[model samples]
Target: MAPSSPPLPQFEEAKSTTSTVLWQLYHHRPRSPRAIALSVLTFFVLLYMLNTSSSQSEPNFWTKFPSQHPFPERPEDAQVALPQRNDITINDTLPHDLEKPNPQLHILLPAQRSSRGSCRTITSAMILGYPPPTLIGYGHEAHGTTDFEQMVGRMKRTLAYLEHSRTVKDRDIVLLVDSEDVFFQLPPQVLVTRFQNILRKNNKDLLRKYGVTTVNRPGPKTAPAVVQKYTQRVLFGASKKCHGAHATDPGCVSIPESSLPPDVYGWKTDIHPDGFLNRPRWLNPGTVIGQAADLRLIFKEALRIIEQRQKKNGDEEAFTQIYGRQEVVRELERRRTVSLFKEWGYKLLGISDATNISTINIRLETEHRYEYGIGVDFESELFFNQLLSADDVEWLKYSNVTKTSALQGSMGVPREHRLLLPTDVAALPNPFNYSLLALNQTTLPLWNKTLDKLPNPEDHTWNDIPLMTNAHSASVPVLAHVNGNTKLRNTWWEKMWFFPWARALLRRYVRASQGFDAAQSSLLGGADWWDMRGGRGGVWTDHESWVRFADVCQGQERDLFDDDLGPWGKENGDPDEPVYNEWGNLVYGKEPPQLPQPPQLNDINDHW
Candidate 1:
């Protein structure tokens, strides 16, 4: 009651007096310009320190951002979505030419000599309905002293050729393989379909593991995180060992573990002396498949690294470093992003511990260049590296259920075969499981009925032509790299299903009509075996004109065909000639043309 009586004097006056006293205290004396400036400077310094502390680097003067900046400072700005399979619209970006149907496949084989191995490679590809290969470095002499140096030289020349080719486009899928050791077992259609499918599935898994996230852009409001994901755009054949780098190097130790099942190789996984049971986690440059642009970028960077380091064994090492650096930078970015979001109280986000630490010390200026979209074929689906895996594959007729059944409970069969047959061991009409491929499904239930429906269907049924299947992973690889043992090259080449009827197969492949059966095309996702170089399959030589298949492969009859095996139509009383085109023209009609003389070399060192 007493306080109320006093307040009646002036409630409003008391409030005004209190406000005036506070204002006077705040501005008892005029603030100096230096004091105001100092206060502002302190606030900004604290903000800069906060940002720089995350990257452990000084802010760049020009950009005012940390060197090797993993991601944008604002978490909201990191949202990135994976590109859809159908979203790739290369046709629109290419130079319009109605005359040319966009070629989807390009094969790159680098060989200095047309040896038995090289001839067999060319012959096998032709037999399997592949377009003519661009024989890179064919006319060049061996450059370096060591095998490694020669390998690097071949890589350099191949890079040069791809860069110069007008026919090759950014979107085209390119297959690069070791000329002498690699063999094409499947048709172009199977290779392309499997490639696209592998990439699709691998990318989908990656997106689920790394691409999804939520972040606050401006404030409390959240948005889907668009983090730049690591995709397996360019896939190289995987190896049991990281060939070129040291054991402790990031290339050898820091790569994401192989995606194969943990028990893929059983108890002897990494301990096997033969390395047959080891997981294929390392990169093998012998066989690579990727988009033209992606391959070009990787090779370009590899060449740069070679020149900078003057490395003799740089081919695989350079590639391994590139991949390792990519993983390292990606890991840094991932760690930075996680730390930033965690600071903002984000929890429950999944982070992978696949790679714990990286020994790679990537240069700050070149951090952006490490992203070459590199990956390895861990399952040996598209490319099989035979470095330490000589006994892993078998030539069995997948369509013949009896072949697998015969070995099921037999003691004479290898232990691996007796354990479990590969997933692709059985007949598979729908190999890819793609619904679109079922458009023109046929009555025959065998996989790749296209091969079965050849000229003499009975003479060369699906049972006759076997395919190479990887026993451990149950994969029918597109191609095989016979790298470890040179002695096995001829034996394995003979084991190929088409080897027995190479002449007949090559004839059938070359003379195939403009369009494949609609059913076959549907199975191949509209891909053709020979659509490159205007459908006249041949080798792109150093000469002005492209060399036809007959020119490069005519003389190597022994390498290309098995005389003892005879022809496919032998039961019908063999045709007049061993090889004849669909129009009854002799497959090897003319004398093989002389190869173009190699350009004069100033010196061995100068050529590379």
Candidate 2:
């Protein structure tokens, strides 16, 4: 019909175009039916080939597994093995004989408190430690105490310990005194070497040449002068008896009475018994020397004198009088006899008329009052002041101030100040002026009451704490000095009590906090949270922590931070954030978190 209306030409053309486009789109867009079918067939072939290769490479499970069989046994052969020992003996005598000579000097100190002042006298012909004639102190104790026996005992123990530890030999003996005033600061080793050289040649000759002095002149008489000369000769070793060869042998040689020379006996001169040349106030007991054989004789004679004194007086009286004037005189006599021993010949020296060795006059005066024992003055304050100067004082003050504000702080006060004003300034005992109004009134028991109130073992943690330990586990010696007057009591308390307590407190605090470990805290970022939390809560906190906490509590950190990091992070904007936090915690977060806002500039301005 009209060629089917020409199939509505536009519609028919549109339909045909749509069908062709659909067919092309279907064919180009992924896989069509033919492609999919080929893909499936290819996948199947690949899988089959893979399965076949695997089967070919792998062992069959149905086949029996191979078993490992034991090898044929071989005949055993027996053999004997015996233990052997090659004995060898070593002889100690050969090594002992080959030991090298020890040259370390052994100094023996035997201090005794005497009436003059604390003194140290050198006995070695060879000067050691410090030279003879060295003026070390004026008239004060080396240590505060004047108990000579106690000093000697301590010195003996110290020396014994030193000797054992240092491996010192027995022959190199040198005796020292604790008396600071007695030791002269000179080239001691030089003097010692000179003395040793002289002794090596002719000990008596050197002593006679060096020992002569104008003091202690002999009376102008034949027999007395002869005896005096003989005494001087024996004492100074101007005579031959001082030599080791004849020291023990009294029958070796004798000075004929007729042949005694005038100068040999005594020379007329003024006696200046003020300095070292004169007898010292205190003498070291160990300086007294005698031959091995003569030691027993001297001991016997000393015992005889002691016995005589005991017989005359009761036991207590005899004991008390042992170190008295009579005993001193007997000791002098016994010393003379000991001097006769060949071994002691070195002690005697020839008196020299040329050298005028001047003795130093020490004038010690206290502006406040005579406090403790006069001997204590040397080591207490007077001597220290003499030795120290204005520059030293200033240096010490600056050092202490600087140290106290440092990270570690100061360790108590300077040693000199501790020795001087030992007690607290507020606790200082009132100075007493001898009241003419109440001169006869019994002094109020102020000193005793004050001492009773003073700090003791029960008052501090270090009261019974031991400062040292030895092989025997003995505690370090504790000493105390009690004075008869107010001044003495004050000095003793200050030096012995207050200073030591202060030092102990500092030391104990330091030792206790030194081993603190900050890593034990279980916090994010492994922070030192104790510091951030104001250093409180646990018992494991250290001194630095407490100091930090105290500073923070006192609002010191605001002042510090205000000057250092400024006040930008005081409020808002994540105070724990790395950029904002002044104390350096980055990951700190509160459990119930709040939204963070930008920091306000006004906050910093307010701080300013």
Report per-prediction Cα RMSD to one decimal.
Answer: 18.3, 48.5
Candidate 1 C-alpha lDDT tens digits along 150-225:
7667777778766777766666778888888888877675676567667777767766544543333665666656
For model 2 the TM-score comes to 0.20
Flag regions of model 1 displaced more than 4 Å. Answer: 1-103, 142-152, 212-227, 339-352, 358-368, 399-464, 513-526, 535-537, 542-544, 564-608
Candidate with top lDDT is: 1
Off by over 4 Å in 2: 1-100, 110-168, 201-267, 270-608
lDDT of 2 by residue, 1-608 (tens): 34544568789899999999999988877669998999999998866553342324433211111111111110011001111212312222122222122232222332222211121122111111121111111222355643443333343343333334332232332323332222221223322332333223333432343222122234765342111111110001111111212211111111111112332212321123322111111111222211112122223333443445433222222212221222222222223322223222343454312211122121222231111000111111101111111111111111233432341123222222231211222131221112222222221111123121324433232222221111010111111111112233223222322233222221122222211122222111111121122222111111111222122123322321222322222323453433313344333444346689877999879978
* TM-scores, each model vs. reference: 0.65, 0.20
Task: Name the lDDT value of residue 146 in candidate 1.
Answer: 77
Score residue 508 of candidate 1 by CA lDDT. Answer: 49
